[model samples]
Target: MVANGHHWDPKYPEYEGKFTGKFLHSHDFKGVTNEWKGKDILVIGAGNSACDVAVESARVANSVKLSMRSPQWFFPKFLFGMPSDVFAAKTPNWIPSIIKQFALS
Candidate 1:
């Protein structure tokens, strides 16, 4: 295995190249122009990074779809002017899990 754990996703190796057209990773678009304008896009995950790509791609692509094997808990990019993850990290551990889930829901 790669030391960084950045190997290919094993879940769908066979499904790879089963489609035509551009297939890009989220990191490819960071700080770049929307070069895929007027194209159809299919983002293959729904994690925060993938969601960012889908949202950005949707602005120019003819159609955009996010593929996920399961639903995920989506969080806002910012809350009260702080990154959501930073805000979440400041949450007190003593708080009940139920309350946290409820508030996020």
Candidate 2:
């Protein structure tokens, strides 16, 4: 068993008492495979992680569906809620004055 991407050994005398459980992503769920290239698919778990996978799959697959346990709470990075993730990274100085004004105000 491994946790946090670290491999553990049961035989290690130093680790006489340690807890570990297998971690799984959406792909690990049964009946979900990479071969769904042109088939309708429903993916579960859509808080934040699942939405990403579902959107990508929809691009290639015939259709992609998501089954979420609860509503999602999402926030967009923006200047006054306008597109900004790309502009912020590429053009940092373009909005420096506005950012400073917003910060001060």
RMSD of each: 5.5, 11.2
**Residue pairs with backbone atoms closer than 3 Å in model 1 (clashes):** none
Which candidate leads the pack in TM-score? 1
What value of lDDT does candidate 1 attain over all alpha carbons? 0.63
TM-scores for every predicted model: 0.55, 0.40
In model 2, what are the clashing residue pairs, if there are any? none
Candidate with best lDDT? 1
Query: How does model 2 score by TM-score?
Result: 0.40
Deviation from native of the Cα of residue 58 in model 1, angstroms: 2.8
Model 2 misplaced stretches (Cα beyond 4 Å) = 1-34, 73-105
lDDT of 2 at 45: 57
